[model samples]
Target: MGLLVKGKWYDKWDYNNDEGEFIREESQFRNWITKDGSAGPTGEAGFKAEPGRYHLYVSLACPWASRALIMRSLKGLEDMISISVVNTLMGENGWTFEEEEGVIQDPVIHADYLYQIYTHVEPEYSGRVTVPVLYDLKQNKIVNNESADIMRMLNSAFDEVGANDKDFLPENKMTEIDEINEKVYGTINNGVYKAGFATTQEVYEKEVTTLFDALDDIEERLEHSRYLVGDEITEADWRLFTTLIRFDSAYHGHFKCNIKRIVDYKNLWRYTRELYNEPGVKETVNFDHIKKHYYRSHKQINPNGIVPKGPELDFSLDK
Candidate 1:
């Protein structure tokens, strides 16, 4: 709902352009964490993979942040890295660490809002204060704010430091995984937001149509295969799972993505259940936070801020 510019906070929500298309800002922090403390792909080196050296700040209400959370769970990095979660309702202040039912106070810097973390890292930091933020506790700087990079780091960077050896981006499936991830990231992962936040009817129609098309394609793919990449669960599955889990609860009604609920899709619904039933995954989901954040935060979309009480989502393992 807001952004930081030259270390200054603004209560602005002008993400749409002249055409009313929601243009998501690119993540600014691009540093990396490697096992040898060397550089991985982008940004600087020296962020060696170590135990209890980094901290993660995430919002359970956020899909991007949830991606990192799922990776952390799958890779078993809970003890190595500490974490703090923000409150569900993001208002004018935009993602504050306020006291609430699920709020986890920021122990590193004791900041009231997420923006303070940005200012603490770089006094003149100019960008959206986003999560999940990978903070280097030793250097007292933000390691990375980009979710995709954070997932990759969590997948393998801490493997030497007692992290699980399971490779989501296995060598044999790397190419297919990358290809599927690219498609899903643009159309399905971000497509719901593009549809939800679109200010014009024309833009909304275009985006919503593309989103369902991608979902339809995915449903067909899952009809014969157990997962997105088939047989095994990759990072692609986890990445898409965050959005799918939130679809019926938040996106379907709140975002006007009502053409077809995920429950209507036989294959997709089954696939979602499979992923949700995965070890250490269901606990990461917070439906209260998910519903409240979207329904209350976006006053422009949902002016009343009245959260709905019934979608009747009962995600459980089938006996």
Candidate 2:
């Protein structure tokens, strides 16, 4: 992992001495593409919804990036907006375009590294170059890098252009969906990182316990409801589902979030399987890419970089 300091690349992991916590910095771009071509919370108005106007840069391994990819496929925006997959193993230069197995090369600019795209957008851009970047093909700039915002755009913005059938974030369920998203994002989604990257044992124990506590709560909540907010599959369910799908497979062992495997939680496990079986959802997941990225990339976590082959998950076979 690397970050840009005054537009210069520096290969270093995140650190926070004051709090003794692995604090994740918020994404810089937070724009949206509405139907009316209006400006979002940030950025300009030229990023209007148009066919072949946008291209998404993502990694199949990343849950955050996977969220956008899922939305794109479900919304039927595949033809409207193109995509590029970065190599899963984020190395000294962070996300790169080194073609290896399933890692898709940068087709838009043919850049050697993903950070090159950031520098292309803004020479002085200073932040972590994260995935799920919505690039404006017409303007040749990053529309938004925030996955949450990109999900919203993919959910609604391109209705007139195409994919007008599916509405992941229905208006009636907005409030409930938002509430679910908040809980999942904080506790379960980012909780794995909180537990894994904890500098102290005390911090790790606190986060791991909190992570499972939230999982238990969700497992209980999912007992009656088919989805997080209601019987209908909404944005909230998709958001939480991504993390749950990755829980036992990656987070449990690699991230040291080993309180209990997600498979042990009956409701969560079934719910995860249900989501994974959804139309176009399963295609977004690339387990080989996901597993290799985590095990090999984080040398500190897995010093030998020898990827594991067991645990025998059957997510690929139909539920």
Q: Which pairs in model 2 have colliding backbones?
A: none
Strongest candidate by TM-score: 1
lDDT tens string, model 1, 220-240? Answer: 999899998979999999999
Error of 1 at 141 (Å): 1.0
For model 2 the local lDDT of residue 157 reads: 88
How far off is residue 258 in model 1, in Å? 0.5
Q: Candidate 2: what lDDT?
A: 0.85
Candidate models: Cα lDDT each: 0.92, 0.85
**Cα lDDT for residue 284, candidate 1:** 94
In terms of lDDT, the best-performing candidate is 1
Per-residue CA lDDT of model 2 for 183-271, tens digit only, reads 88889888888887887878888988988899889989989887888888988888887788777778888999887897787788888
